[model samples]
Target chain A: MGARRQPGAGKVLRGLAMRRPLKEAGVLLVIALTATAASWALRPDRLPLRADPAFYRLELDAPLIDPGPALALYDEGQDLFVDTRPAPPGSLPTIPGAVPIRAASFDDDLLDLFDFLAPDDPVILFGDGNLVPVSNIAARLKERGYGNVRILRGGIKAWIKAQGPVTGTASGKEGS
Target chain B: MMRWLGLFCRLAVGGVFVFASWDKLLHPAAFAAAVDHYHLVPYPLLHPMAYALPLLELITGTALILGLCRRGAALIAGCLTVVFMIAIGSALIRGLDITCGCFHTDGGHAVGISLLVRDLVLLVMCWPPLWLADAGPRVPFLCKKD
Candidate 1:
């Protein structure tokens, strides 16, 4: 390809030159800072805990106790098990000595059910297979300053598989 | 036709950004919780970002709407839309059930394909600014040329 030379090309190019994108970027930054400062002033207390790992951790990260260890803890009477599922139908069973703490009733009944337990007492939450309820309950307990909160791994299904004692027919599966 | 369409796009995108920022500005804690639900942001950065993001949205949105450094606002909005798409897409692929913190922090709306598509449309709206030169002679707001 051959380059074509035009008269007064430099002048034409100079006339067509646009402002640098960087200047525009700087303008945007200033505006962004102003808006952020205004928002911050409006809700200074709304800032979240910066380094709190507890608030950031997901449900899966909640400690999971297998059936064997949970049963051992149960036999030793060293831990309290809280079932996060709704009450099972007449055909399905629940873990022996496990207290029912429905997720729906969590906000209202949490203190009532948990007020009797010491802050350091080990608490385990269980459902059928889903860990959401179990994990949430554990988080709630931890939020209320309860230490040593955990979720039952694989829920009541694993408990049944391990032949753990139950209050009703133990063969059926249940949802969280 | 092109210029008018571009103006329309600019105003619409900016208005949306402003609307989205209002709730997050009012409820930083809820926004932070929604950000936490995404599990994409680092723990240490989450709080600061939660505090900062709404302001960014508010500024950029206003810039777009007012035609103040329209290209710059479009750049920011485009980048934000991309980041949101990636976060939402990752959550969908990973099967993490979460509420999208788009307009609400308590999250009545679930994150899904529909939300992603809406963001994509917004992202598309950002194109006119990226591809076209700024209209008029004098720069608005911050950058006034010699």
Candidate 2:
């Protein structure tokens, strides 16, 4: 029987070197995917594989109305103003007659607010100073089929600066 | 000295990854919301990305700390850091006011120049492990014969 020829040392070393990183990457990916699957199966609070389409519908830069125009809307008494802060209604200053809707309690508040609001109602959402809450609540409102939602530019602080009528305490508290 | 530096870099980068993954792994929904603020990820991919990213961080971080595939773990960590820097840079350029979501999902630091600088520091830390051989002992059963 003829003896089989072995591969050269240089070639074997080259192959090993090339394959090592790819193999490491493969292992890394496998471990990650396996752990992700395990988390999904075991964790009660795991996220759904597919996100809600409502999130996609969220406007990255939702329309903004300045404090002056917002105040005018308030005077007209035809628009709905929502306080998107995470505090209790009377704890912080808010535009008078604005419906307090904390993002945490969005669903419950939306149910109550929806009863009085039509999908096409000119709704304005505001937060303390951070636009994150305002934009998020605006997106949620949009998801609920509220068509005319706009965030108040500069939030409640701007409203307070504009001398807009407010309910509860009117002190300009930051990050409420 | 170089070996010790490599070991330190590995642990530091890996520890950050492991630490950052904790809150994200536990609070997938909150992480999803945080990711949403970036507005870069597509809607359908958001949840899956949120789920997978943390697990990747956790496993890669563990591998790095254990000295099992240290180079590979460092590479992945480096790449993830680069991606994060890009995302943060994009957000800043776009003037999007969003939280960094680095450690805590809720009430985390806002995206700013400081966050970018921190990521740059992390990117620097990732290099030593990639270029230098690990000085630590191999993990039993998990590490292959080098």
Candidate 3:
């Protein structure tokens, strides 16, 4: 910063010269050019991890799996249901036995919530995909290393559309 | 070619930060969720930090591109990049699959070695200003690529 002097250009060049080592100059130049090259080497379309081509996204119109499969998984007891969506305003018909965890509540200290389930339980996540409180929660949970966790394709909207049951108390007498 | 390069890079980087901050302003709850996913900041202080940081990003990005406050904007960007690098590094270390939602993006906003490389590039941009400060009173951002 002493280089913050009047007639700043000369001092600045001096500063740069002092900073550059002759032996390292060629190496540094090559490195900088190589870095810029490497940036080009990697395309924007793929995830960097694993280099698995499957990770590359497909066409946006690729037909998504219907929610019937997810609903079957939930009904079969093969998948533990977790609702990552926000609770509706009043009594809402939620799939019975599905655990409703606010997506807002999932975070790094996931161990705090680990007690919610058995470690090895197969878990399927349902969210209101169009309103992403669900998928975001699932993504965060996946971040926490939940191996068997998955986001329900097209989310719960697909469920109701699949003829999956939504439980609401007729009298608002039963708690969902 | 260089001018186009400069213009594009400035727009891409500046646009990204501004876009990221917009969600924080509009959807405080979602923004809070995004920040909390990182788990670095404590829960109690998380909300304010979430609210302020994105707005800071937005202002700084706007300043950088508009050339209204170049040095300060660059510094803010550099600092945010460093913080993001740290946060992503922490997620990797902790074994989190967290997306780098600096902009509230939902798709796997991939993180890994690429993230480190990305930030380092932005960090290098900080050097131009320092060099320019020494050269003389100059424009906030160089359009050398432009």
Mind giving the per-residue lDDT tens digits that candidate 2 earns over A1-176?
69898999999976766476567867898889887888788875455688976644655446767677789889999988888888887887778788988878888988887667889988888887577678888777778788798888668887888789877565655445
- Which residue pairs collide in model 1, if any? none
- Number of the candidate with higher TM-score, 1 or 3: 1
| Least well predicted 10-residue stretch by lDDT in candidate 3 chain B | B129-138
RMSD of model 2 against the true structure = 13.0
Docking verdict class for candidate 1:
acceptable
For candidate 2, give the lDDT of residue A82: 88
* Candidate 1, residue A106: lDDT: 73
Please tell me which predicted candidate would have the highest TM-score against the true structure: 2
TM-score of 1: 0.56
Candidate 1: clashing residue pairs, number: 0
Ten contiguous residues with the weakest lDDT in model 2 chain B:
B130-139
Residue A106 lDDT (model 3): 55
- Every model's DockQ, to 2 decimals? 0.32, 0.40, 0.04
- Per-candidate TM vs. native? 0.56, 0.59, 0.43
Candidate 3's DockQ: 0.04
